[model samples]
Target chain A: MSNRSHATQERILAAAETLILGRGFSSTGIDEIVDAAAITKSGFFYHYADKNEMARALVKRYLEKDNQVFTDLFARADSLSEDPLQQLLIFLHLFAETMTRMEMTHPGCLVVTFTYERYQADEQVADMVRQGVLTWRQLIAQRLATIAEIYPPRLEVDLEELADMFTTVVEGGILLTRVFDHNKHLGRQVLLYRNFLRMIFSPDPSR
Target chain B: MSNRSHATQERILAAAETLILGRGFSSTGIDEIVDAAAITKSGFFYHYADKNEMARALVKRYLEKDNQVFTDLFARADSLSEDPLQQLLIFLHLFAETMTRMEMTHPGCLVVTFTYERYQADEQVADMVRQGVLTWRQLIAQRLATIAEIYPPRLEVDLEELADMFTTVVEGGILLTRVFDHNKHLGRQVLLYRNFLRMIFSPDPSR
Candidate 1:
């Protein structure tokens, strides 16, 4: 793709992501993205064949951006805290801060909110969402594995299960936050997660 | 309300609930509910001042129905399994079954899917969803309290936390299931829930 064409495509994806996050996938249209990007209909199709293609690009680009964004928080968390347990808690808090800001403007997750709509109507789009979540799951699992390595006695812990719980709870918290229009519910979720981690990491009571 | 009118109104509410679940609130219309119920538009207005009013009725009715449904399942689970941990596992199993069926018909929560849309446009409907979730949280908290009382060395797990986690995971599982259009993700969620409960109940290995 030419440099100009690539810039136009980037503009189109950026606009679509904002719209999809705000209005949801079904309610948003390609024309709206094109309009938001200040590009014509012909220009929109040159970048994306259709709305589905745009959605796929949006998911892929969003995931890449998020991965880079969170990596800084994770590294800061690790550098600032010597204890793995503390690092985990701080990492989660930072994640929530970034997440809340993103959601303050958009009430819900694009992947989550659109997942159900595509599940029955469009298989390829649905697969993108599924893969996105699995990618999220893998990231969490890696963190858990690191924690388990640091705390060898925590043999009872299953990193995969913990990762799943983390992902689910985060998504759940987002849903509640949007539904109630309050960040308190999401904060409560963070508190609950921290407590769960405490249970696993604290010196065994019998020790 | 007259007996005939009450019956017609109930039918309309049920039809609205199913349609809202299947197509989402924004995509569904008052006319569709009337058509589904075989009632006239005038009758719909007589029963419910507007779509929001009908949504309120559906949420209230769903809460009542859910209470009865869960209570019956809990009673059966308690009778079949004397162990508190076993009861928790059984509950997860039952949750999975209900979720799978709901996905076959509609992939997201009627309150959640619509609440995201209406939260921006209608405060009245947003409060309706908040009330619905608060009622559910109370019901689930009570059940978790009862289970906590029976667990050994209980450590006094937080009932509110458990309820929040339960609610969160199910919603997340629904998101995953919808994204994948598969039952395995939900099944995995049930398994993870079972493990989490067992962790709370099982004897501390160090002990």
Candidate 2:
């Protein structure tokens, strides 16, 4: 694809994602996407053979972006602190800050939007979402495991479930934010999860 | 309404909730709902004037059922303990147990389903969802307030946000459960939230 064509595909995907997030995958049509992208039907067909292909492409792009964000945040957090637990906490703080700052532009997670409409999604799309969730689990659980090696948790906890809490809080936060139209809900929830981590792993009981 | 007609309405609402929860509101057609309910198209129309009315009715019925469950669980927890904190803890424990037992039959939350497809929902439906979330917040926040009075939290915390965590965990847990196809996720997440509460409110720092 030429530079111009690639740009057109990017625009198409962006438009599709916005529409799908607002309504849902089943309700968003190719015509609306093409119109929003300022492209023709042929242009859409050129980029995606069918709606299923487009859906697959959309999820693939979404997961890649998410992976990059997590990677960047963790790298930044590591640079700020050598302690694994502190790194994780710093990452959560940074993430909460980012969510608060992006409230205006944050359309919401496509994976979640698609999950609610999974009955309409093909197996490949479903698999991508599942893998995306697992990727998050792995990323956070690794840090928790390292922390556990140094500071055994005061309470008996499942490392994996605790890791999953990061995703769970974010997902639930987004839902509350959207429903309540309060951007701070996401940030506050993350901070609450951060506090939970502190209470669990901090050496000083008072702290 | 006659007894038979009221039963028909109940059937239509039940079928509509399942279909909407699966594929979303925009994708689910009246024909499909009627077919699922084993009723005629006229029968559906007789009960609901249009899809919007049906959506409203579905949400209303879902919220009532949820309210009843919480009420019953809290009542049971109260009978089990006099301490506000203990009652709250027991309520969460019972809730997790209920979720685990109902894994096979739990079709997922309709309020969440509608929130995802809010663009396709009318104002009334949206208000209903917003109110349902607030109700949860109020219910949980009341308990937390009572607990805080008895045992001032060691950490600085917002009672409302703390209350909101209950809804947040359950909502996020349901999402994980659906995506992972593991019923255990929801129950485990709830238990984790319960643990967090223990950490936040327990008088014994060691405990």
Candidate 3:
């Protein structure tokens, strides 16, 4: 694709994501996306064959962008501290800060939206969601494993479930934030998770 | 309404909930709901003027059923223990057990589903969702306030945010459970939240 064509596709995907996030995939139509992207129907058909194809492409792009964000944030966190626990804590602090900085309510997650409306999604989209969730589990559990090697947890901890807690809190926080129309809920939940980590791994309970 | 008419309305609501939970409010048509309920299109119209009206009714019923469940569970916990902290702990334990007993992947929450598909919902539906979330927050926060009075948390905690954590964990857990096609994730998350409560409120670090 030429530079202009690629830019059009990007605009289309971005518009589609916003619409889908707000109204869900089944309710969002091709005409609306084309209108929002300021492109013709032919321009959309030039990129994605159908809505399902668009959904697949959209999900792939979303996961890639999400993965990149995590990689960049954790790299920044790791650069600041050598200790695995500190790195995890710094990463969460940075994350909460990011949420706090958001100018708009965090848009809902596609994986979550798709999961609830799974009957409308194709098997390929469903498989991608499952993989995306596992990827999050792997990313956080690996960090927790390293932390566990050094500072034996005060309580018996299932590192995988504990790792899943980060994703859980954020997912839940976003839902609450959207429902309440408040932006602070997500950041507060992230900080609460941070406190949970401290109580579990810190030698001094007072900390 | 006559007894038969009430039973038919109940059938329509139950069928609508299942279809909407699976396919979302915008995608699940009245035709489909009437078909699922084994009623005529006119029958559906007799009970609900339109899909929006059905949605309002569905949300109202869901919130009430949810409130009753929590009330019964906490009451059971209270009857079992005089200590507020123990009652909170027992309540969480009971909540986890309920998730574990689910024969199917827990059907997703309507409040969450509607929140994501808010563009398709009316203002009344949106207000109900906001109120439902606040109810959950109030129920759990009241319990936490009682616990904090007795034990004095080791960490300086925001009781409201902490109460929201229970809803957060359960909401997130349900999403993860659906995405992963696993029954155990929700129960595990509830148990983890229970552990976090123990860590926060218990006087002895080792407990």
Candidate 4:
């Protein structure tokens, strides 16, 4: 009985994620999610008191899965690529690959969509999104610092600032992609970023 | 009669702009805008067909004003300081001053808020925003090229790429400022940008 109940809850969550990503947070209703999941209203309310509660559960679950993928990608540093700059490049490629797969096969970033939709409506959810963003930025910053350490005299750039820039570019790129329905622009952005990376890693005469 | 009619329309536009900047596009409703402007529903529709139409008018007005400012900023080339790098610094300072004033005096960019809100919701408005962004990037690229003419060959980074980066940073900074309700982060971003300008304008070491 418990196994069947758990399965039903998972189905509902999966359906909610898809619906929210496609139609956005505010527009997607509880009725749509339950219908997609093949569940009754009573079953849905039994699991979640309201749509907000369901969204809270969805965000947490989505973040857990997303973080796992990020952790795995950043792991195995010693196994391949001795050069930190090359490792960073590999990470970028992997990041793009992961995003392409998820967006094409599943849906978009729930946190980004939710943040845009619900940030002003609900303070508690907004705080969660803000903290999540900070945590993600810190992760990128730490990796950038590690990569910067591989260079002679380290780097002239502030790793934290660079990380923020990187995060912004990726997020901004995703936004542009959604607006235009193309990944070609993001490819150009990546190339521009590569040049920026080269500018930093190369020997500086001004230094 | 026309003067009174014009004044009423202007008042409605101004009130909507202020409200949208402070609270975001989605959260601000027609009722609130009417309330804020002290206008009737009939009067509101007299000026704008709908909220979207009002936003379009606001965007057009903003772009006109922005174009005038840009022209003035770049007009005095010969009379100003001879140093290209110094000129760039002064430009950044002037731009920062205007941005700070906007935030302090009124809400931040109306176009920016509109872009984030309506980018996904409406296509025509999104195109307007995309063009607005592109035009700003192109203008900055022209400025960077002007600076590059005063420097050595290798010191000249891709002007378009650099301009795009500048736009990205400013947009990201403003978004962060809105989220955190602070300008310190924006200050840090501008400082970093100034440093980048210095790095680019400096002589090439490999030469």
For every candidate structure, what is the RMSD over all alpha carbons to the true structure, in angstroms? 4.8, 1.5, 1.7, 4.0
CA error at residue B6 for candidate 1, angstroms: 6.5
Question: Over 4 Å off in model 1, which ranges?
Answer: A1-12, A29-49, A77-90, A105-107, A145-158, A201-207, B1-20, B27-60, B71-107, B142-162, B184-207
* 2 or 4, greater by TM-score: 2
- The lowest-lDDT stretch of 10 consecutive residues in candidate 1 chain B is B150-159
User: How well is each residue in A112-177 modelled by candidate 2, as lDDT tens digits?
Assistant: 887777645488999999999899889989989999999999888898899999889988888888
Q: Estimate, for each residue in B88-169, the C-alpha lDDT of model 4 and write its tens digit.
A: 6666766666666666676466555655456667666777777777777787787678778887434435676577666666
Candidate 1 has a TM-score of: 0.74
Interface root-mean-square deviation, candidate 3: 1.8
Model 4, which residues run further than 4 Å from truth? A1-23, A29-46, A76-78, A82-86, A100-108, A147-156, A179-181, A187-191, A201-207, B75-89, B104-109, B145-159, B204-207
What share of the reference contacts survives in each candidate? 0.48, 0.60, 0.74, 0.12
Q: How close is candidate 3 to the true structure, as a TM-score?
A: 0.96
Task: Name the top DockQ candidate.
Answer: 3
Note the Cα lDDT for every prediction shown: 0.72, 0.86, 0.85, 0.68
A5-40, model 1: which lDDT tens digit per residue? Answer: 888889888888787776777777778888999999
Clashes of 2: 0
How badly does each model clash, as a count of residue pairs? Answer: 0, 0, 0, 0
Q: Candidate 4 lDDT, tens digit per residue, A1-207? A: 799988998999999998877767666778999999999999999999888888888887887887788777766433458777766666666666677666557745666565556667767667766777677778877766776666642236677777666655655555555555655444445555655666676455342
Candidate 2 residue pairs in clash (backbone atoms < 3 Å)? none
